[model samples]
Target: MNFFYFAYGSNMLALRLQKRCPSAVFVESATAEGYAVNFSKLGRDASGKGALFEKQKSTALGVVFEIAKSDLKSLDKAEGVWFGYDRRTDFEVVTNSGETIETTTYLPPKMDIQLQPFGWYLALVVAGAIENGLPQDYINKLKSTPYQIDENQNRPSRLDALETLKSTGHSNWQDLFTSPRAS
Candidate 1:
């Protein structure tokens, strides 16, 4: 069996998602009405992570992917579903082609993310957003999103993971990972 998933954040990257679920495959760029992509999840690293929020006038743009149902468990663990998120399958993602897909997504139950995301984390998201050719405006919106430098200097850039996103034509990805935040 296979299932569709709406990947609005880092999972939007083909390389990253494929590593998590070897059977993952991109479906199309899609939109989630009434939601906005934001960094609000309290990550294990003690920094902010990506999640969704309700925004009446805005939609969270992302990609839809089909994955083997057998991979669901690993996906859950990788996304920290039980620790910081709850899995939900009731949402609909409308593809650019006007086709609606039935899929699952993970979101925290409460809006507790009060800090900025780490630059490295945000870079993965921005790169993935660009990889799938999400709307330019949306991509810029992601780039403009405020992110905090990873305070823990000892924490290394997720180089292995980042390689996946950088493969998507972002040779300058190195800068984006630690670019100066808007002052």
Candidate 2:
């Protein structure tokens, strides 16, 4: 059995998603109604990660990925599903082509935390959004999202991800960084 996973945040990046599910294939660009992306999940990297924020009249833009059932556990582990994000198959997404697909989405069990995403983390998101050619206005909104510099130069994970962006044709996230909150 295969599963449809709607990736709205970092998973929007092909490279990042590839690392998690080698067999994963992009189905299409899709949107979930009445939801918005929220940087409310506290990550092990000491930065905030994206979660779905429910509100009326808001929709989130994302990509649909088809993953093999066998790879679900690995994908779950990569997403901290058993710990941080709670996986739910309750959501539905509509493709730009107007097809509605039932799929899985993740959110924090609790969303009380409000924190800015690390610059590198936010960069991963922006890179994915641009690579997938999500709406320009949505990309602008992503670019405008607030972020922080994870200055602990010793963080290999952060550095490694930034490095991986090169393969995706994105220069260093910080080097090209521009935040509306900054200026």
Candidate 3:
């Protein structure tokens, strides 16, 4: 069975997904209605302590992945769905062709504002929004999204780590850097 996984965030990054599902096939870029991606925090990543907000929302813009049924389990585990996302079948519309296709969308489980997104994660999201054909104004808005660095302090409202990586040619350097450490 082939599964159409509607990707609306970091998964939008082709290089990132290729690293996970080596054989994953890329369907045309798509979008979900009544939804837009936003930068927010998830609960699990917060760990009841210092938490940074990740990019999340019900209406987030992402990409679509068509993968073999055999790879579904591995893909799910890679996405951290076991912790916060609930897998569901939904409709994906190809903005360029006006085609609607059946696909699996991940509905995030409710969590606190602590599940902050790291710089690399946010970069992928920004890339996804652009790929999904979101306007420059919207992209700029996403680029300027604000989040709390900690409980008492909010960081600058702009791309941080991801932007840095892009500048340093490290956006697709997963094998090159195991941890978030700078190259």
Instruction: Give candidate 3's error at residue 63 in angstroms.
Output: 1.8
Off by over 4 Å in 3: 41-44, 47-60, 92-94, 113-115, 131-134, 147-183
TM-score of 3: 0.66
TM-score for candidate 1, residues paired by index: 0.88
TM-score for each predicted model, relative to the true structure: 0.88, 0.92, 0.66
Model 2 TM-score (2 dp):
0.92
Q: List the residue pairs that clash in candidate 1.
A: none
lDDT tens digits, residue span 1-183, model 3: 788877666666665566567667777766566565544425344422111123345344456778878777777776566666667765555543677788876666554543455544555556655555666665666555543333322433224434444654555523222332312
Native-vs-model 3 lDDT? 0.55
Global lDDT for candidate 2?
Answer: 0.84
Question: Which segments of candidate 1 are over 4 A away from where they belong?
Answer: 151-157, 166-174, 177-183
Please, what are the lDDT tens digits per residue for candidate 2 over residues 36-137? 887888888868898887879999999999998888888889889867799998689999999998998887886745688888888888888888889878
Give the lDDT of residue 172 in candidate 3.
53
lDDT of 1 by residue, 92-153 (tens): 88999999878899987766657688777887888888789887777767888888766565
